[model samples]
Target chain A: MSGRLFHYNTLGTLMKGGFDGAFTFEEVLKNGGIGIGTVDHLDGELVILDHHGYRFDVTGQIHEVHLEDTTPYAAVIDFIPENKTTLNEKINKEILEEKMLGQFSSKNVFQAVKLHGRFSKIKCRSVQKQEKPYPDLVDVARDQAEFTAEDVTGTLVGIYTPALFGTISASGFHLHFISDDHHFGGHVLAFEINEPLITWQTIDTVEQKFPVGDPTFMKTDFDYSSVLEDIAEAE
Target chain B: MSGRLFHYNTLGTLMKGGFDGAFTFEEVLKNGGIGIGTVDHLDGELVILDHHGYRFDVTGQIHEVHLEDTTPYAAVIDFIPENKTTLNEKINKEILEEKMLGQFSSKNVFQAVKLHGRFSKIKCRSVQKQEKPYPDLVDVARDQAEFTAEDVTGTLVGIYTPALFGTISASGFHLHFISDDHHFGGHVLAFEINEPLITWQTIDTVEQKFPVGDPTFMKTDFDYSSVLEDIAEAE
Candidate 1:
């Protein structure tokens, strides 16, 4: 009923080490869409908008994503908010999620979420390129590096997928951050809002494209239960 | 490691009525593998083996599936037994699952199960094709036709997926049925097994192929929470 959105693949597949890029950044950014995902090779956190890709790596560095590059997973939609709301109240992540959920009519629809404001303190994390004989995702959480930024001004680009759709997407809000100054950002873990909330929404119509070319994604037969747990622990 | 499993699409997608078959019945049985799924248009239950696809319609009629027929969802792997054990005790479905799960080293991997024996009673259900704009899956659960066979001798073909993979796959066991005489079969709901049980297993290396051509599957954007509940209720 609202505007459109696109999803590339299931979160469960990505969490299971299906990390080869299935689509290019240019392909993902057609029509100037905004979204979040990990870069190919599981290198870092990715935020796409303004016809550019910003990568927040684990080494405390930000890099310009090449247009020719690719991604294994991403959800993007042309930014045309069908609904708008304002909540000028201080809140935490859980509270913010609840507030956004209040605006949704059903649990099955995907909602594109954008919040522009200042945060008290934001904590985020990213993982590096995993070497072969990749350990279980739970085992890799031990190595994830968490970054912190205090009094940060950023636009949290996120999507809210219902918990029942937890396989390829997260059960709830999944936001990736990019600061105003483009200095610090990562996969959002914890954050507190200041005030003057600005929110936007659009429904996503996703097309999941599998990576049949990658032998690993095509051939790996291992269990992802631990990986799911690892993702939960990291979250 | 011994063979491969072909997964047409996610169970989540199937519940959404993306019932157009993606692969042919003969393709699904190239190796004479066994599995469970729904026919195109959600017509009824489908169980394949010995290069023959069996259809169990809602009217309790059994038909031989043409090789050219396709399925929206199915998981099939070459039947190569990696392990075998005798289960010579009378037990209910729950008890049998618990006993077999104990043999697995982990909960994340797929477990293909086969059991041959007499059952005091078996209950199964098959859904008819839904009209569009298709109703929500939860709304249609009230209409599923439940069928029961008493003192039935049949073989149960099943797959056990991890709870973590709950979104696109059943979190636990999903079984389909075929009587010893090839007369009765459908999606298994419940059954009580007699003595001299038979079981088979082989790890499933599954590759999910999304339906890229189905515009509905590619474009639908909505939450599946109620649908998941509907599946639970039906199961």
Candidate 2:
């Protein structure tokens, strides 16, 4: 066939989720016209037979097959297998590192803030914890009290909030901030695991309601303008 | 937590070209809160914590877990685990059906054509002898022939092109007729698979090359206006 064939590990995981396991090679071959073969002897390799009688073996991949209608225009998407090496490599770690790095503050910001206690104990939680641990208020206040004379207009209130997920391994320190008394006012902010004072937002609270699942009786005041780009998953 | 998990097995052949496995569960938790107790686990089961924090175990007969990504998001997608299932379920069977169903005749058009003695025996090395036994020529012809009037527009020539696997599965067939005998005729006639008769110019001659590495390049010079809506697969 003149087309391509894609082989995807039926057992492979995906971002969407996992598989239910209701498919087989024999079932795949029920369709007439395409050839069926084995890849790595997996028992269900798809053999696409194009109009030109060329065969492509697609063992584990997703493929697009298009057949045009031209004399001598015989083509098929027999095999469009992808190289596995690229997939195995992790996504750019530097991107995550840079993001985390930007969330931290230099030795200068810490030197500038004055805390109530000289020593404050920090305890991280396990995945199995009941309630998510919150950052200590006294320490947060110190981190939130930074004042930079060099940058004339920046304020310290922009660096503290309740939405921060704490610091993660290899990533920098994480912090969150909310603006003023606007309960749902400014977008929730985040900072790196080790990098304090550098604020970012993972998600923006767009709408709010008194009770969950009561769509009809709800209150929607969160504008979500500040962190729109951060929470834009699709579109 | 409120959403249910469903699983089903293919009894006989369910030949709709694809299957969806949906499972459901009752009110284990409500409104993103924890609920239900620990249940004994088993192999090959999928556990998902819903918005309400109720756990669901989804199991399948033939498929297995491939991958899983969970956020506090609303819905979930379980991709088929095995290569054959993903290929057939997600790619091959689905795309093939879409392409064929979109453009080709709903009812096999070969049934309408009056063929001479034992046209079924007219086998070529281009097609797979094992997959398709002779009698299905009606479906084959229907998938490959263009509609033509009995009037003497020109000569009818049958062209045989091999698919990628040295089979007739993805090949194209066309018939051409010349109004005036000339090496470079401006206007002539041609018919192809799933197409009607049409006049063409010199450049429109059935001599176009396959685009890049496209294996399924059977472009024909017949009228596709009627079936264009039914056969377009870009979506």
Candidate 3:
């Protein structure tokens, strides 16, 4: 089966102010897809699937975003899983990347990556929204709150883009987490898994959807050099 | 009002056997959008507006694709005209681009471009379906059928993307022409407008939907560099 990855905005433009989103949260979910993104203006981390959107703020407080709410950046795909491979050996994050990328012939297209089962350990972060006269993405990232969870049973939802994607899409493995119990999760910073169930589908196509609310997006002289550097450092 | 420029597939990918499409013709028209694409496997050209899809083939024969038909690549956006201006002076293609781009605050985002009225001259092209052993896009383009219409009353449906988009999108300007009588149209190759009615809207968001076919897409070594080159050269 083929897949399409729907991205709300490019990471580069969002650095300037794409955070002021154009569509409502409900409108985005009507497609009934799965993926990850941040709330408008970087207020929190978001995880969506099956028409429900969960937001975990910098304080780690889990809140369900209403349909009327908007997001600065978001992504989704009508996921129909075609694989269920259970790894037999323990794996670290780096090795996991190697094993997965090795399966694909190329690294340029989008990949729908999902992992189920318990994690030995995981580290994640979430950012708080900035006030008017918003700061650069790097600055916002500098103050992002970090959290850690151990021996948690949950699922990981994310997308993998080619490194060349750079600012348009977040490069490398970008993921968000939500526990099975629906108690803990956020943007993934680090993780360790032992023989977890892995399911991935390479997306044949993608749509880069931009936000409509940011008026200053076009006028700003965003130095992408620094913006990209910050994104890489954070990753 | 806000607009979105929906694209079917990346220009680069379409060059490498992306002809196998996923969504049905009616599904792509549900958004009440206007744009263009090709039938699955490059069978015919497509133009959609007002919940209707118009198909034109290499023979310049116009037909309507059934709802069950699929498109390898297609794009559309809810057309809510935010600007309408009548150009009373004789104009060429270059000056039209100048006038349209000049009205927008920035050329970094997608713009839904539509020109209505009688065209002094217009040239277009369309390709036929390939056999089992599908060749490269540039090869298909080599044998594309070309058509030109003079003094036709119709509308031009298209979009202008940022140059940085390169292969991810066809940068500069991309358009398709369909006569008012629905008897003439194809992928726009060249055109000259004299005192036509022009309308444009800055798309606030976009969603790229992929067709649910082609199993070997992820495993194929698509030469994006060449594919991109072909798109750029053709554009």
Candidate 4:
């Protein structure tokens, strides 16, 4: 659940100097559209994921401009366990895995790909109101009959960086996988959720570190190779 | 030589989740060591490459350090062409090619490896520097033709951003490729020459971009794929 997905522009060599052929860092700002798709369990409640659209420099003859493909994270579903693992325990683990992997999401958008159901593809709109707009995932998991939040007390689900959202802890996201099946799938649902990708100057909040002893953490001394390898091996 | 050298500890099985006999991120940081070699051709007189001294964490251990490796950039005597190509132009092209390859140099200080001559196996310093006493590097490439300060424009060799240094620029480097020789079997010499990597926090710099008015400049509003193919074919 708390896992990451790295999406390198596979279609790079076919382009200009590569992925950003004519789209230099400067050009990207002038005319680029980040493509994003989200299936919100809740209607219009914070678009669980939002791609702060792309920019364009000039208009075409018909006044139409093409937006760049900019979706950062894609929901990749691997087979989920079919056995009867306690609902809460399964949910917590799902959240945890997704959060761990979410760290690898684009630095600009602290987005985490959430997984809902033990099935093939996740549909766009099938979640409850209580879980809308960033669910109270931790609190909800506490009510499950077979599991408790204590299972992941010190484990890190996400990291917090102050530079991203001003004084508001913007970047790092933690995973809180919760399980529930009877409501929708009847096949225990898994939620991999985390903080939205916050950008600089866009939000009024300042960056802040996560609470002490969180597993999803980043520090100057922390070596990144091991983490990279861990994620690499999982894939 | 600006190229870096790195090695793995076990060479295998580090990526197997590292949880149950898997290599964990915590272990990698504890043992990783990185060495940076700076070259000389990129330096200018009175233009010191501001190697910010090593920085430490609260525990009083060196968390990060910087160093320099200097080598010559002159072409191998045998490789010097009777043809009209300039040595400077050839060296510049090779260096640019390496950058395009995305070759960044960073080996963990704890798990440090010995520095070798540019791209060759020739070792430079005897004792590998430790990570605890973080230190900055100053490389010097000697015995070459002299040039006036005006002739010594700094090239953007590298860019670095650490929590402490913020954003720093590097220049000191000389990349020269040599053909085989009877005496010292010539391999690629990422040789360091007399130059220094400098910082960007300054005023009155000489760096300039090619203007759009230049006849060589080309602009187009097309897909990146088409443009890239055309450039490659033109070259």
lDDT by residue for model 2 (B1-235), tens? 0121111111000011111121122311222111111111111112222222222222112121222321111111121111111111222212423443233221111000100111111111111111211222222222331222222222211121111101111122221222111111110122122122211111001111112221111121212222212211100
- Rate residue A176 of model 3 by lDDT: 88
Residues A1-235 of candidate 1: C-alpha lDDT, one tens digit per residue: 4545566654666776667777788877883367888778778888876657888887969998887988887877777666677777788888888887776544455677777778888988887876665554445556888999999898888888655456557767889888989998988988998664555664534444445445565446646545445557654
Provide the global lDDT of candidate 2 against the true structure: 0.18
Of 3 and 4, the candidate ahead on DockQ is 3
Query: What does the lDDT read for residue A122 in candidate 3?
Result: 87
Estimate every model's Cα lDDT from 0 to 1: 0.71, 0.18, 0.75, 0.20
DockQ value for model 3: 0.27
Q: Can you tell me which runs of candidate 4 are displaced by over 4 Å?
A: A1-114, A117-235, B1-235
**True interface contacts reproduced, per candidate:** 0.10, 0.00, 0.43, 0.00
All candidates in order of lDDT, best leading: 3, 1, 4, 2
Q: For candidate 3, lDDT tens digit of each residue in A56-133?
A: 899988888899998777778777776567778888777777787886435656778888879999888988877777
**Model 4 lDDT, residue A67, Cα:** 40
Off by over 4 Å in 1: A1-165, A168-235, B1-3, B202-204
Chain A TM-score for each of the predictions: 0.90, 0.14, 0.92, 0.20
What docking grade does candidate 3 earn?
acceptable
Order of the predicted models by DockQ, top scorer first: 3, 1, 4, 2
lDDT of 2 at A172: 25
Q: For model 1, what fraction of the real interface contacts is kept?
A: 0.10
Q: Mind giving the per-residue lDDT tens digits that candidate 3 earns over B1-235?
A: 4676766656666777677766687777876468877787777678886667887887889988888987777777878889888777888777788888877656767888888888888888888777656787778888889998898989888888865455567767788889998878988888888787888888766665443344555455566646457886555
